[model samples]
Target: MSDEHSPLIPASYDIVWSIVTVLIIALTIVALVTLARSARRLTATQALIWTVVVLFIPFLGPAAWLTIGRGGVPVERT
Candidate 1:
C-alpha cells in the first residue's frame, strides 16, 4: 500500500532542520555582537557602511570583512 512509502515526515529531516536553525541563530548573534562592538570604535559612517555591506553580501563577505578588515591594532589614549 501507499502507506508503506508515505513520507510526510522523517527523522533525518527534523534533525537537519533543527541543526540549520541553530546555526542560523548562532551566526546572527555573532554578527550582531561583532558589529555592535565595532560600531563603538569606528566612525558613524564607517560603521553604517560595514553593517550594510556585511548583511547584504553572501557567504564569505561578512565573515571575511569582520575577521581581517576589522581586526585593527589598538591605540592608546592620551
Candidate 2:
C-alpha cells in the first residue's frame, strides 16, 4: 500500500499504549503479592481456595480477595 493510503499510528499514541500496558502489568504484580500475603493470614483451606481463585481467575480473583475475602471492614482513621 502507498504511504498516503496506509493507516497511520502517531508516535504519541504508541507511547501512551506502551505506558498503559506497563502500568497494567505492574498493577497485576502488586495485586498478586497482596493476595499472597492475605492468604497467608487465613487458615490452610481458605488460603488454598483463595490461591486457586487468584491464580486462575486473573482480575476478578484479586479484586474479590480485596473486597470480599479480606475478612471485614476497616476502621476509620482521622
Candidate 3:
C-alpha cells in the first residue's frame, strides 16, 4: 500500500511464458508432421512448403491449413 503504484511482476511469469512458447512450437511442429506424414498424397515439396508457411505466420498459418487442408484430404463417403 504505497502512494505510488508499482507494477507487480510474478516470479513464475517467465516459467509460464516459456511453457506457452514451447507449446506453440510443438503445435507448429505437429502441423508440419501432419502434413509430412500424409506424404503419399502431399508431395514432398508441397508438405515442406506448407510446413514452413504454418510455422512462419502463427495463427494465420494454422488457420489457413485447417481450413484448406481439411477439405483437400480425401474422404470415402458412401
Tens digits of per-residue lDDT for model 2, 1-78: 656432576777878988876765665576667766665467788778877876677567767776787655243355
lDDT ranking, high to low: 3, 2, 1
Strongest candidate by lDDT: 3
**Candidate number of the best TM-score:** 3
User: lDDT at 18 for candidate 1?
Assistant: 90
Model 2 TM-score?
A: 0.52
Which pairs of residues collide in model 2? none
Clash tally for model 3: 0
Each candidate's TM vs. the true structure? Answer: 0.56, 0.52, 0.59
The sequence of per-residue lDDT tens digits that candidate 3 reaches over residues 1-78 is 666533686657777988878877777777767766565677778777777789888766866676787468675455
Evaluate model 3: give its lDDT: 0.72
Candidate 3 collision pairs = none
lDDT score, candidate 1: 0.66
How many residue pairs collide in each prediction?
0, 0, 0
